[model samples]
Target: MKIKLGLLYGGKSAEHEVSLLTARAVSQAINFDKYEVYPIFITKVGEWIKGNPLMGPVDTVESLKISKETIRPNSITSFLPIDGDDASHLDVIFPLLHGPNGEDGTVQGLLEVMNLPYVGNGVLASAAGMDKVVMKQLFNEAGLAQVPYVHFIRNEWKNSQTALLQKMEGNLKWPLFVKPANLGSSVGITKVANREELLTAVEVAFKYDRKIIVEQGIVARELEMSVLGNDEPRCSIAGEVLPTKDFYDYEAKYEDGTTNYAIPAEVSPELLEKMKDAAIRAFKVLDCSGLVRADFFVTDDEEVIINEVNTLPGFTPISMYPKLWMESGLAYSDLIEELIALAMERFEEKQ
Candidate 1:
């Protein structure tokens, strides 16, 4: 019998559109003969809608967004995969979601509670990886070299705005990159070269998350590597992100078509080795499963800095994660198949 695979996409987070795109890509690439594909979309307003298993691969994103009229919004009853919810039962789930509610362990927790095997990082890894400050702390524990930075919550920033500003200015260098502690896809990241920009950036970041991180900007090359598997995860060859803009922000990453990627980045053998080691170390430190996109910064002097690890990194055909793997000789469809197997393996181990 064909395995039942549910494609969980469309979330309440800012990366909702990216999720839709990913669902479309996965559907187009999925082996229909091996697994029956189902669509479970979470609308922008947080509606849980389930569509029937596709007779073939999805041709457009609009088909994937069609909701079953019987299913109510925000209803968990349909997702439990129990007796009452017959059609929702599945062998595995591929959560093609990025950022916040979907990628930050909230959805993972739900899957765990329902005893369903879902692809990607578990609760601990997802939660830790979602929060920049927490991920940095884990990197520190793993002996990872990272840039200097500071973090604060909305309340702290409000109560001691002056002190926080002073601390940030004193501790970090100029041209800082401020980011929402618990968001991804560069949703609320801002590059500030001065005090005025810093204040504005903080307010903007707070709009997405309660906490914010301000890292000292560095003059270094942006490199990324893909990590796959569970206990014995491995890293792919490094890829470079070349942004036409001042920095790689939300627009450059997914919109505006201003970002260019260099697959199999030009790195010395020694530097590549260092990056591979660092990426695997970050993966193991967070106890990540399935896959992770480990992004880094290599300075002019070849100094490697751990920027951050994306627990559920972009999985589109053009996304760095899959592109890096493809350069390493893994086809897109095979990569997805491997991730699903790894998910089942992790779930069995948990049981």
Candidate 2:
């Protein structure tokens, strides 16, 4: 019998469009003969719509746009198995969501309560990874070297704006990067070189989340490596993000053709070894499962600094996660299969 797999995508987050694209890409890459694929789409306005099992691979994104009649916004009773509501049971779930709400452990908690197996990080890992401040703390505990950063909640910033500004200015250097602490895909991120810009950037970041993070910017090459498996996770070869734009923001990462990537980046053996050590350390420290994308900054002096770990990184055809794995001799289809297997393995282990 073919295993039942649910492609959970299109969440109530800023990365909704990216989730849609990932759903389509996974549908195309999934081995239809081995798994009965179903679509569990969460609408932009927070509707959970379960689509029928895909007969075969899809070619367009529109086909994966699963929708249904209104059933109240933010209500998951339509498909979610809660309050004894019988959801279409699946062997496992592949959540292709990013950013807040879905990728930040809220959805993972739901899955855990339902006793369902879903691909990627568990609650603690997802929650911590989504919050920049928390992730940095965990990294520090793991003896990981990271750039200097400061974080604050909304009320703290409001009550002590002057003190917070002074704290940031005194602790961090110029050319700071302000971001929403619990968001991804560069949704609410700003690079500021002065106080005026810093004030504006904080307000901008507040538009997305209650917490904010300000990191001291560095002139280093952006490198990323993919980690897979559970207890014995391994790291793939590193990939370099060569963005022509000033910063690797949303527009530069997904919008136009301003960004270029170098697969299997040219790194010395020592550098690669250092990155592998850091990536695996980041993965193990968070107790991550299924997969993770460990992004880093390598200075000219070959210093490897842990930037962050994307619990559920992008799986698009051009996403750095899968691209690095592919360059390491794992095909896209095989990579998806490995992730599914990892999910099942983790689920069974917990039993």
Candidate 3:
């Protein structure tokens, strides 16, 4: 029997649009012969609707929107088989979602409860990877070097405004990056050069999440490596993010086509090995499975400071994660197949 793979995308997240794009890309690349592909879309309001098994590679994003009828409802029932459809392959859910309920452990936990297999990290890793402060603390325990940062809940920020400002000013340098504790795709991130901008950035971040993290900005090259596998994850060739804009914000990542990338970044063999080591350390430390995009900040002297990992990094044809793997000799379709195989491997191990 062919594998029943559900392409789970879209969420009540700021990264919803990106998720849609990922779904489109995956639909285009997936093989129709080996797997029974299904579209499981979660609308912006958090309604889950599952589409019929795909017949072939999709052409347009609009074609993948699905639903000429009213939304069946966003509950689990929407994804379940009705009376006649007995052999539907929700066998594995390939969650191509980003941020919050999608990237965080919420969706993973739901899958766990249903006793179903899905792609990417498990509940513990997903929860930790989604929260910047908690992820940093775990990185620290692994003895990974990182730029200085301070984090606090919304209540703490509201109550200790003066003291918090004092603390930030004393500890962190100018040109700070403020971000929501639980978001991705740079959804609620701001680059601030002074106190006024920092204040405004704080308010902007709080709009997306109750907890926020502020990091002292570093002048370093942004490089990333893709790690694949479950118990023994392997790192891909390094990819560099050269943002012409102020920073690689959401716009530079998706909308604007200006961000330049150095696939298989020109790092010395020793530096690449070091980065690979750090990446695996991070993957193992988080107990991540399926895949993770381990991002880093490399200094001029080639010091590899682990930044963070995306539990479900963007899988679009052009996204850094899959692109890095492609550069490492894994084609996009093959990468998807590998991820499905890894998902099955992880599920079978759990049983």
Candidate 4:
């Protein structure tokens, strides 16, 4: 029998629009002959509605916004079959989601409880990856070189404002990037050059997440590598993100489309190997499965400082992860197939 693959997207996240774009790309690329594809959309209001199997690739995003006539607020019963109803039995799920409610282990936990096989990292890795502080701690333990950063919760920041500012000023350099600990897509990240900007940035970051992380900004090239598989993940060719903006913020990532990319970035053989090793080490350290986009900051000296790993990276056809893999000789459709196989393999291993 053909595998029943459910594509989950449109999450209640800052990256919801990107998730929708990814779903559209995956629907177009998926091999309809080998598997039956279904759409499981999580609306902005947090309702889960599953759509029927696609006869062929969806041509438009509007066509994919399927709503169950009977679906109620926050209910997912429409997705669960009644008393062994085979129609609702999904062989696997490919979650094309990014950021908080989707990639931060909440959806993964739901799948775990339902005993459904889903793509990408498990609850632990998802949760850890979403929280920058936890992810950095794990990276440190893995002996990965990282930029200096200080993290604290909203309460701590509010209670010890003066002291925290003093600590950051003393330790970090002039330009620091303040970010929400549990968000992606460069949302709620601000580059502060002085104490006045720092205060405003911290306040802005707290709007998205209770905890915030401030990293010492480094003048280095932004490089990224994609790792695929479970247990033994392999690294893809490194890609560089050359942002023309002040920094790689939300607009540079998705909106403006001005950021120039150097696929198979100009790297010496030794530096490439070092980055690959660091990427693999990060993948293993996070205990991540399926796929992860390991981002890095490479200095002029070729020092590879591990940045962070996106458990479920941006996956549109033009996104960095798929593009990097494509450059490495894996077509988009083949990458999707491999991810499904990896998902099933991970599920079977757990069983």
Best candidate according to lDDT: 1
For candidate 1, what is the TM-score? 0.97
Q: Could you tell me which residue pairs clash in candidate 2?
A: none
Per-residue error at 239 for model 1, in Å? Answer: 0.3
Q: Which should have the higher TM-score, number 1 or number 3?
A: 1
Model 4 bad stretches (over 4 Å)? 70-78
Please report the TM-score between candidate 2 and the true structure.
0.95
lDDT of candidate 3 at residue 166, scale 0 to 100: 92
Rate residue 255 of model 1 by lDDT: 72
lDDT of 4 by residue, 62-113 (tens): 8878877535434655455453668788888898888877789988987887
- Residue pairs with backbone overlap in model 1: none
Q: Note the Cα lDDT for every prediction shown.
A: 0.90, 0.89, 0.87, 0.89
Q: How far is 72's C-alpha from truth in model 4 (Å)? A: 5.1
The digit string of per-residue lDDT tens for model 3 on 218-309 reads 99999999999988889899999999988999888888987999998999999999999999999999899989999999999999998899
Off by over 4 Å in 2: 68-87
In order of appearance, the predictions have TM-scores of 0.97, 0.95, 0.95, 0.97
Q: What global local distance difference test value does model 1 have? A: 0.90
